[model samples]
Target: MHLGKKKAFIFIAIACVCAGVFFALKTSNNTVKISYDPNDGSSKTTTKTVYSKQGQTVQDLLKNNGYSVDKDLYYYSTSLADQASKIHNVRIVKKANGVITIGDKKIRYSSVQKTISDLLDEKNIKINKDDIVTPGTSTLLTSKIKNINVVRVTKAQVASSEDIPYQTEVVADSNVTQGSSKVEQSGQNGQKTVVSEAVYHNGVLVSEKVKSTSVKTEPVKMKVSLNPSDIAANTSSRGSTSSISSVDSSNASSTSSSQASTSTDSAGKSTAATIGDNTSKSKGVAEIKDDSKSATVKDTTQKSETSTKAPDSSNTSNNQAASSASESSNNASMTETSKKSDENSNTSEKSDSSTITKTSTVNIPFKTCNVYVSNLAKGTTQITTQGVNGEKTVTTEMTYKDGNLVSQKEISSTITKQPVTQVVAVGTKEEQTTTQSTDSNQSGTTATSASTSSSSASAPSSSSGNTQSSLSQYVSQTKNVTYNHKTENISASDFDFLCAVVSQEDNSGYEGALAVISCIMNRADSGKWGGSTAVSVVKAEGQFSAYGDGNYTKYLNGKSSAAVQAAVKDCVYGGVRNHSYYSFQAKAKTTKSVKIGGNYYQ
Candidate 1:
């Protein structure tokens, strides 16, 4: 038969030149466009373009737009024609002059409530009456060109995990395995978040980040909240009594709006001062880890890393839970072992089991979280911004071991900026360990004294995970500041009792109060109040969690009571020489952190 039709015309011209050189180099490097409609009630302009062939995705245009981008939005379907085209594409088009479009959004309705379940149960719009809506709302509507596209349905955030299962402690020549640090991996968050995303056409907030972020099954590192300079026996209970008795350069601008005569170092002990900062110059990095692995010790002493995640966190407050499983398998790898005279700076050899092995990073320097990230959906958020809406793209993730943070993550990428409403992480810093192990093959010097006793047990693995020597307990903390003396007006009544009782029940916004103001600015108020500037102005608004936002809703609607009496008449009239450190809230009863001191500053 003519030689089998010339070998089927050379296998149909090599499958049409390998499908025309893969769709002409994937349609000139991807064009991207997909969105469709047609389950019998089809309308909202009936999208369904779905282009990307030979590869095809936007996750196959969301399994052909019946939805399933994973990490959250799911509904696979048994295909009763995709559950009757997802119930006639979620119907609701009423209009006998009272306008009600639903999908493109017209709203103003009246008669027949047209089905998508009587227009989301007569416009309350909650849906879940056992979901499923098709043009069979009794299949009536004759024309409005077929409306039905108001799909607000959302649900994705159920990926949470924490295994950390790999930690060995043989190190005998007197405890040696030391180099590594990062071991971070805060994944396993189905802490679900769909605030909005049913199919936005233009504004573009369509999220679907479901890689599920794995690989922590056995990574271990869990230090614990301690850095008031590492607690030298917490100097008389983390010291500092703020008593400046004299730099009264007229009471030093009278504490720019009363944190309670908030400034006193000429002798009384307020600690630090100077708040001229127009800010700018804070490269932002609460913790990505490693600015040369800091913490050579100087932590000063304080320990309290409380992370309830907002008391189970609001509706799962950005959903963060997955960190209690630990077998502790630390392969520990940060190999520095230096003494370089300079053989071309030790060439670069050591990470090559044939590549791909990155799981150790300990940049350590955090000693500054007072647990404060208050209603901050505006600008200046680090670990990458998230003031929330009005400006979005908020992504979050956390999983540190040896340095503390076993779990806490947020995922909402695109990373928006400047419309911050609320996000306050006041203070947090925990890397406490009390290790003290020693016993290996009952040592008696064999083989060059076993490599100098494993190089002096790995040159002091920075207190080797707190070695447990003296009943090992590094830091466990709780700090409180509550200066009281007042018939009121102690600086506009102490900045309205610290903007209404301690910035609202002491924020869950997180930061652990800047590690209790860095263990009260590295301790020893030498006669009290080290280096001064009002303890460096609330330690720079307790480590600046993006200062403030949306006028914090005019300081939460009370229209910021005349900006808290112009910040207590600009801290009692120096108009706050160069804005004496800001961030003071109002509308109070008592939250606590007042200053005046012992018998009202004597």
Candidate 2:
């Protein structure tokens, strides 16, 4: 059987401590020595041997020695048992209280900011000014906070408000009242945010995140104004009244002349209007008989004088004068009608002026413009540009008409790069041995070439191929193995062989090693009566090493005896997995109990 360096060099480290041996001897088993003298300038010493029983630390040792462990002092040590692994010298400080601090990493909320930065600050630790804060501003006060360090930090802080645009909403306000609200869009009341990103004081964000929001705009109340034109039209039509007066002054004028006749006329025309004054009595012939009766006139004159005193018979001339008086009154009424026509004309003109003013409106040009851009990143895939290398600023971009920008943009660039991949040439050793090919840079073919590979680390590759196919089959099959198939009865040795092959120190390009492990660990627990080896390792409820704190890499690397290596080899060559791909249960435990299929001699 071929042995690979007898247990992988069985790495065990030793630390020599001669002084430690002496110190331990003095205080190994707790030892005591002390002296005190009240007398003037005199001293005494005494010694006693003791063994440490309860606590194993040096502080405990000092306290037992009657040397008060200083509360401010720190102590550190690496137990001999941890020598194989890296042994850290623990930090310790005696506290005023009974508890002592190891590294004194414990922090309180009041004394610290509950973040890595505040924790360091509380202890008076000064970091670079450019250092980034971690755990975020809102990290909880807990012992879980961890500080990641960097030499110097180049901070790029960006504070932005995503317009919380006044939470605009269109409400169908048939009857909107002031200070009232209609849930048009329910406005969600937009918010402006203060976003801060922190990097490691020296490194990138190792952990923690926080988010918060505040309302930027108060919701607008629903409201409306009465339509002015509707009110005005209604008022005018509902309240205005029209009137006309037809006064025929001629009727009153005729009434004066016909008053006496019409009152007692045989035809009874008293209520009817007169065209002219009608004769109330006929003219008497007193003038013609005046001379003949001269002798009798003396006696008759006395009689005639008495008759003339009675009443004048003809009344036409007096009536005509009365008609003239009525005409004068009619003329006064016509003057008043002319004044009213002038007043109405003025009122109509004023109303037309008012209506025209209310309807006039002019458009004000829109101050804002929009830019419809295509071929931009769809989501927040941080578009970064080198404006001033280390420090960058963000500015708002405003789109205006005529292709002009109202505001300048902050980082208006994008770059795209291809994905990364690695490659390997399979069956090359045989090709080199038989075909003798020239180097990639050479033109002529060479003599017989040997199959040799360099041990130096290869450079990171810059090539892209089909994601899985080209690289998977080339995986080195010569290395050791370490895995458990789910169920189908694969032996322990076969599994280890597969693990060994995939983990070859020399590269054979198996990009799917981790993927295979994932599949095996997550497979169904069907045929093999249980689950995969990966699941079985964690079958202890929650203590499975894969999911536990144990490091599988360390376990695999650590001290293995020669016998174990031999046993591992025995199963790989002729055991459960001869040369075929197999599937198994996902929960099958007992990896040591597994065997190769159809190949075990036992």
Candidate 3:
């Protein structure tokens, strides 16, 4: 047993020596040379010598070495880990979760995404082209990055409408009374449609703009008639004759005579002395006759001896004159003889006399005069004083012979009411010019006010506000004016030209139309190819292709389409997209260029 023990001790000694040699070789083979890069902010690198057995991972190795490493930083090379002769290169870094700030919200995330864009897409966060972003989406994520910011932006189109007031027209009528007016037609309000674009950031409105306006209905003009009554009253105050004859007559005559015949006794001898007595009575009468045509006188006599004879025509005139003197005596003798001769016959003589006279009267009228007033405006007339009429009376005497008028003579003259002249005022002042101002608000509405001052030549200092007062006093004198809802800075002609150019250039669709207009505006702003104004830019020689083809002038005469007009308005008001493309060609393809409709822009 001692011999076996001594042999066992020697063998044990050899076994112990072999075991020490194997352990030394295994320990040497397990040794690993590691170089770690923290990749934090510090530039210092770490080197470590670790002993690891086969089938051990990099994470296990680091943990065994008492080194804490983030999961994101554990990496190892397969060739270095598998080959005992090669140096092992391992790296460890500090990493953090991505912090995203979108508007007012914050989100923490840990993802394997390579870029900010990939991270946002993975989180389903959307962004618009106009939205603002910090650390752009394509930027690579690193340990230095702690936060990402996104500003949400939204664009929209808003449409609204406003009322367009109608105007009144006044017409003058001479027959109508002053201070009175009659409405011929009632006025009606018109309608206009407005389109606007609104921009919002984080649910709050930031900016708004008008895109276009369209007239939906036309206004009906109000018509009124005015007249003055003074002219009619003055015409009616101005002024305009009727005669009779009669006759009456009475007459009476008487005559008596006595005679003795002694002629026969004287011739017979002295026997005639024997006394013989005789008695006779005679009477004569005259009568006058008057008629409308002629006058005549007649005589009749009675005697004791009577003889029947016809009167001669030559003695008629003399007899008529002589009969006028003894007219009464003859009439009385004839009456007594007729009564004595024919008491039972019932006959009697008649006498007559006639006289006639005539008279007359006359009338007159009124007048008007004019007075001028220099303070009043032209086409104005006023009556200061009214007119009155006058009258005159005239009398005349007329005589008639043989029942016919023969002579006339003035007897008296009289004055009635006297005439008064009319007074009128006519205006003779020059026309005055007025200035107007318009203001606009955020609601896209406008208000206008006006002020006026008359010229120095005809108006006094007191009449400085006449034009403004007249506008208020006579509201019916207002005229219609065209207004642009989008932009007031551009003139009507320039706006119209832009619309025409856009319509002619791109009538296929609205997008292309807007693109064409943007090009024109870009040229205007560039100040190289054309003038600054929109009109000057469009009409510049050999600029727009449409103008060179003679299509621009033809389209300008007509109305533009609604889409084209809206595009023009938006561009003018800065509602369209901005571009540096100043030229376009048809069917051309090139890099860094965009194609819209049928044209290529660069």
lDDT of 2 by residue, 463-518 (tens): 32111111111123423333332223234433343343222211111222332332
Candidate 3 lDDT? 0.49
RMSD of each: 37.8, 43.4, 43.8
Error of 3 at 243 (Å): 74
lDDT (0-100) at residue 350 of candidate 2? 13
Model 3 has a clash total of 20
Writing each residue's lDDT as its tens digit, candidate 3 over 392-506 gives 3433333333444343333333434554434333344544534445665675777666656443321111323222112111112312212222221364455667767776676
The 10-residue segment of model 2 with minimum total lDDT is: 351-360
- Where in model 1 is the C-alpha error above 4 Å? 1-219, 222-236, 247-602
lDDT digits (tens) for residues 1-602 of candidate 1 = 99999999999999999999997875644433333322233555333433334443344435554643432212222222222212212222223223434445666543333444565467776544333344434443323423444444343343322222222111112121121111122211122221222222222123434444445243332222222222211112111122111122122221111111121111111111111111123232222232334211111112222232122212323433343332213322222222212232334332111101122222211111111122211111111111222222222233333364443222212212222222112111212223223345667434322111111110011334211111001112222321111111223223333333222222211122222222222221221333332223332433322222212222331212222222222222211211111232111113543321100000
Better of 2 and 3 by TM-score: 3
Cα-based TM-score, every candidate: 0.16, 0.14, 0.28
The most accurate candidate by TM-score is 3
RMSD of 3: 43.8
